[model samples]
Target: MGIAEERITRLHQLAHEATASGDFDLAREYVRLARRVAERNRCGLPKSFRRFICDECDAYLRPGVNARFRTQSGGHVVVRCDCGATKRYPY
Candidate 1:
């Protein structure tokens, strides 16, 4: 893979590790940096990372902690971030 792609992946990995270690703040910052790298390279964020990145505050979401997930009727899944952003995804 290219250097930019590798950097992006590394940042995402660090973000995941930070979240796993109960450091939500670092995880959020890592994700934000990863997004910047991706944008500078004109690339898209990974699918796995996309779900965890809050669209409103750009915070990294840890399910049940910083984010609340709800599966509603009518083929909708909602993710509510601590920043009061509600995102709906069609399942």
Candidate 2:
């Protein structure tokens, strides 16, 4: 993988660790930095990275921690961030 992609992945790992340790601010910073790197390198954020970040608040999500996950009858999964931003994706 390219340097930018590798860096983004590393940042993703750091964010996950930070969140797990309850350092949410650090995780948010990591997410922001990853996005900046992706933008500068003209590379799209990885799919998993995009899905795990809150588009409205820029927070790294950890399922039940600061976000909620639910399945709907509409045949899609919903992710609601603590900031109340909702995202839906097909299963």
Candidate 3:
């Protein structure tokens, strides 16, 4: 796999471990790291999947598209595209 993919996988593993160990903070941190790697790699959610990516920006579309709350877990995560555009979808 590519470096970004590897990093994302590692981060997921770390998050899982942290969650199992009751380390919500650590898990959240790992999630953040994964997001960063995904953003850097310009990886976006596939249209066939439950997510959508912005054509202008390769951000990962997540859930909570129009929620008032500001929680990161269920919200759409996206990366800024070259044209400074972003997309969102249900996580």
Candidate 4:
């Protein structure tokens, strides 16, 4: 992995840790920083990282904590962030 990718991965871990510790603002900062790094490096964010972040509010989702996860009958998974942004992914 390149330096940018490594930094993003580290930031992802840090964000997860911050969220677990109940410091959501710090987690959001980490998420935004990681995204900026990826943009500057012209690299796509990791799939796991992309799925866990809200596109509208830039919040790191923690499933039931700040996001709701559901499976629809249409063969897709729906993730709704606390900010009311919803994302759908095929299963």
Which of 2 and 3 is ahead in TM-score? 2
Kindly report which residue stretches of model 4 are placed more than 4 angstroms away from their true locations once superposed: none
**Compared with the true structure, what per-residue lDDT tens digits does model 1 show for residues 1-91?**
8888899889888987888888988988988899889889999888877988898787888888789999988889899999999988888
Clashing residue pairs in candidate 3 (N, C-alpha, C atoms within 3 angstroms): 57-81, 59-78, 59-79, 60-78, 62-76, 62-89, 62-91, 63-90, 63-91
Ranking of candidates on lDDT, top first = 4, 2, 1, 3
In order, candidate lDDTs are 0.87, 0.96, 0.50, 0.96
TM-score of 1: 0.88
Query: Which portions of model 2 show Cα errors greater than 4 Å?
Result: none
Number of clashing residue pairs, candidate 4: 0
Residues 1-91, candidate 3, lDDT per residue (tens digit)?
A: 6877777766666665665666756655666666677777898422342132334332233323311223257675444333445444455
* Candidate 1, position 82, lDDT: 90
Pick out the ten consecutive residues of candidate 4 with the lowest summed lDDT. 56-65
TM-score of each: 0.88, 0.97, 0.49, 0.98
Model 2's alpha-carbon lDDT is 0.96
Ranked by TM-score from best down, the candidates are 4, 2, 1, 3
Cα error, residue 51 of model 3, in Å, equals 10
lDDT of 4 by residue, 15-72 (tens): 9999999999999999999999999999999999999999998899998899999999
Worst 10 residues of 1 by lDDT: 56-65
Output the lDDT of residue 45, model 2: 94
